[model samples]
Target: MSRFQSKTLCRVGILAAMYVPLALFVGIQFGNVRLSFGSLPVVVGALLYGPLEAALVALVGELLKQLLTYGLTATTVLYLIPPMLRGLVIGAGAVWMWRRGKRLENCRTRCFAVCILAAVCTTIGNTLVNWLDSVLYGYYTFAYVFGDAVYRFGVGMLNAVVVATVAIPLVVLLRRQRVVQEVKRP
Candidate 1:
């Protein structure tokens, strides 16, 4: 029990710290396109721990990034909604998966599905937030919201894929190392 608790705490701290630096420094940029892998840690945390831990991870990381990068703009807090929601969706899906199967023989497939679903939800949430920010700051227009909607979703999907690709093997390794307790019912 102590081991489990300690492991959880360590993992949570690592994930939260990982999120900020990654968000601040790591990104893909090509012309006007940018891709961020900041959600990877959040997704991994949600899958390993649960919703509350996941949300905390997202909050700490994003809040710190906002303070450091943008210095608390009006939309700073609002922009955090998508990553937190992604964590929530993934964490909730994990619970659902837990309920559905004891062995979870198809864990990989299920993980992929959950990641994709979370990405979709995040894309929608992000779009709404962007639109709200634009309206509040006086850049509102149909084109502003809908024009790049598809592109944003594509980026979300790509991010989800990257997260899952990295997370699955990492989680498997953690379980193998007995860092994370995997309780099975017989």
Candidate 2:
């Protein structure tokens, strides 16, 4: 494989590895919601590697965690959507910012904004997934679904906060270490 491909895979592997343990142990799960810093590595992967690689990292990491925690079930497939969306939206946003010449190291405001955007998107995605899961599984009635959506959105926001808290420092560190290189001039 080429150097770039190898490096990207390595990043995905390492981040995925980190995500499983965080989700499994460090996170809290109440009912259908999982709030953890697990996705933080995924977001960091997105920032460094872009959406596809980040999505891969999230998918593998979250799938492994779910497999271990709940075993292989139809729900597992349904559950993957939120994290994948999280990675895709966050990673894509970061890449877009980079492509537009926003140096994360030098532009703290832009970095914070990107992180917030990622968090909001992740929250919305998670809320939607929870809503779909409820409806598809017939787990609740209309009133409950609405309440659950709101609750999940709140939980998702907490998760987003955790993701941003972890991701921002990690990104800054990567930039300092020169692991996150400058975007090429267009």
Candidate 3:
């Protein structure tokens, strides 16, 4: 592989490793809080690597968390699909926004745009997944899931906002320090 490809692979591996534990902790803590910061890695991976990498990271992380928690349940596996899809959506949206910002010559604006896009995408994705789960389990009607979806979406948006705000600055700092650049080029 070229130096760039190797470095990119290494970064993705490290980030994927980091995401498992972080996501597990966040998933365990998820309750009344509609969203959690676990999705940040997905967003970052997507922005840096692309949508496929981000989704793979998300899928692996979710599977790892499931294994650690209960060794896998049918319900868990079923629930996992939506979040994976959500991660893809968030990643794709972030990448798009990032590219758009670059084209516009407004890095900060792009970051903000990606943040908002990630939040909304995640919120909508989570709500739909939760609704699907509810339907499959026969616990609630689509309408009820729709209501819960609203709540989950709100929570997801809040989490996205928080993660984006925190992550963008950290990413900027990392960029300034050349950490990401070094990893990409080395």
Best by lDDT: 1
lDDT of 1 by residue, 1-186 (tens): 697677667767889899987877888874344577788788777776666678778887888887887797889889888789888988887767767663221388878888889899988988898899999999999987878788878887887888788888887777679886653322
Q: After superposition, how far is residue 152 of candidate 1 from its true place, in Å?
A: 0.9
Model 2 per-residue lDDT tens digits across residues 1-186: 998778767777888999898888887887877777888887787777677888999899989988998899766777777788878877777777777766442455665566666666766665566678787778856676566776776677667766677777788888789976543333
Clashing pairs in 1: none
Write down the worst ten-residue block by lDDT for model 2. 103-112
Error of 2 at 36 (Å): 1.4
Runs with alpha carbons beyond 4 Å of true place in candidate 1? 1-11, 30-33, 101-106, 181-186
Candidate 2 backbone clash number: 0
Supply the TM-score for candidate 3.
0.72
lDDT of 3 at 12: 64
How large an RMSD does model 3 have?
A: 4.1
Query: How many collisions per candidate?
Result: 0, 0, 0
Worst 10 residues of 1 by lDDT: 97-106
Per-residue lDDT of 2 in model 2: 91
Q: Candidate 2: misplaced stretches above 4 Å? A: 28-34, 104-106, 179-186
lDDT of 1 at 11: 69
